[model samples]
Target: MAKRCVPVTVRWSDMDAFGHVNNVQVLRLLEEVRVHAFEDLRDHGGPSLLESGVVVARHEVEYLAPLVWRLAPVPTDIWITAVGGASFEVGYEIYDAVDGAAGGGGGGPAAGGERTVYVRAATTCVAYDLATGAARRLSATEREVLESWTDEPVPFRRRSR
Candidate 1:
């Protein structure tokens, strides 16, 4: 799997009265993961997606377990799910390494370790032309970069028929 694993720090403020990371804050964590991945891609022959203007068209998130605050960063796995002319889909899994050990950074699960998934999510992102303020088709370089990280769709538990 060509996924990107990012270690995201959980802030104390991210917790809610119930003593777990707030549901809304989970989205923020996902954003952090994406930002890290985008930066990495840029350094490795990929387009500077942030600078070029990518917008979130939609998001689907499913919470499986409550994520509690911890000293160690949470391991988040993200990958490209689909690539379209002007849009793309990204999938994510927020999880904990087995025995609370932070997984190896970069990609994939920890060596011979299981993961306790906290959330599953997918985001639809559209490439935008900042000057024109309109959606734009992905460039050849951008498409190649995205395809290199492409993986299976998010295994969402619930889906509409």
Candidate 2:
């Protein structure tokens, strides 16, 4: 299947007292990505993805650094890392839109030149029937949409990889 990409924005509320994005918001950020993945999968979800039983089976996030940066504007970029039987994983990298680097990309005094900070996140989610509590597979149309959602080698350290 192809990778899916979604853009996410950092809201002022998303930041923390330290003047950075809060830890929990990253999960929400990842979820926003997954929601868009389903959106992509379902040809840009209208009501089904939400109406359907979607649940987060597991979530893991690696905070490379604190959310202590300021930005005039934010961009959105998230991906559907993988989709399994009734389950899927999502990944994201929120950074400065201008420089296009992860976590400043260097360890020297010149490192701070990057416009954005890289924060990689991965989450495992599941689709279930609310009434029956059974796993549900995405419909054919949805699969096609999901397959169209992203490019290859989605920046995720997946279980298979």
Candidate 3:
């Protein structure tokens, strides 16, 4: 997949006492990336589903390694892994940029290289009518926005869980 690069800075406060980013910080980082995605959609004159009461119904992340505290400029890649009728999933990978300065490596920095993180994850979220508390479908524009990010054919829907 051709992943979209989202270069971001790490806040000093994002780290925990261990001098590495806390596990919980992954959720926050993921959420930020998702929100940034909405901005991309909007810039393309696409619809954003964030305000439509689409909440995370599922989240699955595999913590690969610890991220020691750093000054700033972390590179995080984000992409639409899948888009469903009332839900969608996004994939993320947080990488340290130092190892990438010489410029070349996929996902994280070179194995065991400094300035790289190895954590990655995927999350699924669905839209619902806040007033009715029922599933709501995505708009055509939103669907287009999702498809713009990947070569994967759109996924078929299943009964809501």
Scored by TM-score, the top model is 1
- Per-model lDDT: 0.92, 0.60, 0.71
For model 1, residues 1-161, the per-residue Cα lDDT tens digits are 79988989999999999999999999999999999999899999888999999999999999999999987888899999999999999999999767665544547555787779999999999999998999999999999999999999999999866
Q: Tens-digit lDDT track for model 2 on 1-161?
A: 34333556567888888777899887777777666555554454433665687777776666666764344433445666675666666666665544442334444565445544456666666777889988888666545544454444434443443
Q: Cα deviation in Å at residue 90, candidate 3? A: 0.7
Clashes of each: 0, 10, 0
Model 3 lDDT tens row, 29-146: 7788778876877777876666666788877776767766566556777888888888888777777556453244566635555655556777787877889999889877777778
For candidate 3, give the lDDT of residue 26. Answer: 68
Give model 3's clash tally.
0
TM-scores for all candidates?
0.91, 0.66, 0.77
Pairs with steric clashes in candidate 3: none
Off by over 4 Å in 2: 1-7, 40-47, 69-73, 98-116, 150-161
lDDT of 2 at 102: 34
Off by over 4 Å in 1: 101-113
Q: Name the weakest run of 10 consecutive residues (lDDT summed) in model 2.
A: 98-107
